[model samples]
Target: MVDESMRAALRALPKAELHLHIEGTLEPELALELAERNGVMLPWTSLDELKRQYAFENLQSFLDLYYQLMAVLKTADDFRDLMLAYLKRAAADGVRHAEIFFDPQVHLGNGLDLDTVMDGLLEGLRLGRERYGIGGGLILCIVRDLPVESARHVLELAAPRAADLIGIGLDSAEVGYPPSLFADVFVRARELGLHCVAPAGEEGPAAYVTEALDLLHAERIDHGVHAADDPAVTRRLAEEHIPLTCCPLSNRRLQVVHDLRDLPLRKLIEAGVTVTVNSDDPAYFGGYIGANYEALAEIGFTYDELKALAADSIRASFLPEADKRALLG
Candidate 1:
């Protein structure tokens, strides 16, 4: 639906990605390559077959394949290669800053230690900054369906390294697990001065959004697409200026929103809510940050809307005020 000029402009805009899962950037080529190197046998025969398997019935369905893909990523070099590949694509797509999420439970459950994961990823990130000039930050997220004690243990593992890990987040299946379940862990994260965020309304109800802000004290809401269903909740979020990181393509892929028409971005923006577009799981979601913007453009976003969305991303990021202003400028 977007014209050539509009697509060009969207590509040229400098943007920040705030909701990316690093593991989710595992492209088809890299996934298979890693599988070969690590001696892990996958169910699919060819990469095209693997791509076809990305179709999801729901969040849990996607998580099943997502975890299976992790079996190929066993060593430090595999992690480094994964992040490096994403950064290369990000730099080309005009992503100036990226706040990346990593699920430690997935890696640790696969017998990879936090240190190995962090060291490899941080090395790639540092190299990306120097080689590609891409700014980056790390966020450690807990799988919501997992036990509360597991979330706490992950927090403890990350607390001492809070300087390296900038934020704490909750992801995975959001329907059954509510933010209130991790109240103690979120509290501890805040007490330690780490930024907090959670995906509240992807599959969760509007009340779960309220619990995220009130009980978990989350600074931002990720994939809060359903907040539009509640006027009172929508008004509060708009008035308070809490940012919602909305992923259009991801929603379509996960069946959260039936189609691009189901996206509430324009409505959210019109109602004065700060909604920023992101690619939640780029590999699974079928694009990176730029593709998310392009998808919105095809759905009828103007140049100004693109600028506003980019600005929202800046405001939504946990970067220092000066850094944000620099990016905004």
Candidate 2:
């Protein structure tokens, strides 16, 4: 069993939460409250029924409920409240910086303007930096399952907010909709001076990892666990020093790994891949950044190894070099 000192140390490690989805932070309790306030109807009558949906067998299973729950977030205030709640929770977990992910496509489908989504989230971010001292940037992610044309539209729609948007990312289903499908838009995003990141190899193959690297030109891979399935891909990632934001508990909950002990975190680290622990969708998976490090600990990682992962996270963050050096100090 882990000791109290270790637990306290885990809570105190200054880290960066790089893969969080703002929408995924919606707790079931908050979901209900927002539903009532927005006059939005959630089909589930009891909280227990809603909680039951957390048993997601795979990525698609969780996404179905994720999109559904987002119906409650209708206004700027709701978005501000959601981001503030996540920031406070992360701050308590010792997160000094966070590169949050936001999906504007979902809100667009709900008939909301892009300005409402960006303005509300930016306000919350401004307040978060003031109140919590959590410094970070936002990566606008385009849903892969949607049309390439739609992705292009989002990039155009997001133009006015370019200064606030640090990067562009590709997320959502990865199976049939390959990273190559979004190549044009990703190139367009880079031309606009945004960093590139993409979700690859979680449900896709090692080839998909390569596609993300070569085609979409993703600087970092989110949920890149499937790279473990191929030695060559792992070697390339290690040699290139590419960072993989592996969401351990999220992988387990989604049945990506049947046992935490079987996770390839140690192997990836040993192979020289810069691996970082993160909460992909904390509310949907189980916990936040602190909870993720704890889950990885369940497999018997030592203190030094855990600290190394936290440091890797800082290095992998998009923070200015000066800020990153300060954090490292």
| Candidate No. with top lDDT | 2
Candidate 1: tens digits of C-alpha lDDT, residues 70-121: 8999988888889999999988888889999999988888998888899888
lDDT of 2 by residue, 255-294 (tens): 8788988777778888889999999889998899998888
Full-model lDDT, candidate 1? 0.87
Clashes found in each candidate (C-alpha, N, C closer than 3 A):
0, 0
lDDT values, one for every candidate:
0.87, 0.89
Pairs that collide, model 2? none
Which 10 consecutive positions of candidate 2 have the poorest summed lDDT?
53-62
What local lDDT score does residue 240 receive in model 1, on the 0 to 100 scale? 84
- Model 2 TM-score (2 dp): 0.97
- RMSD for all candidates, in order, please: 1.4, 1.3
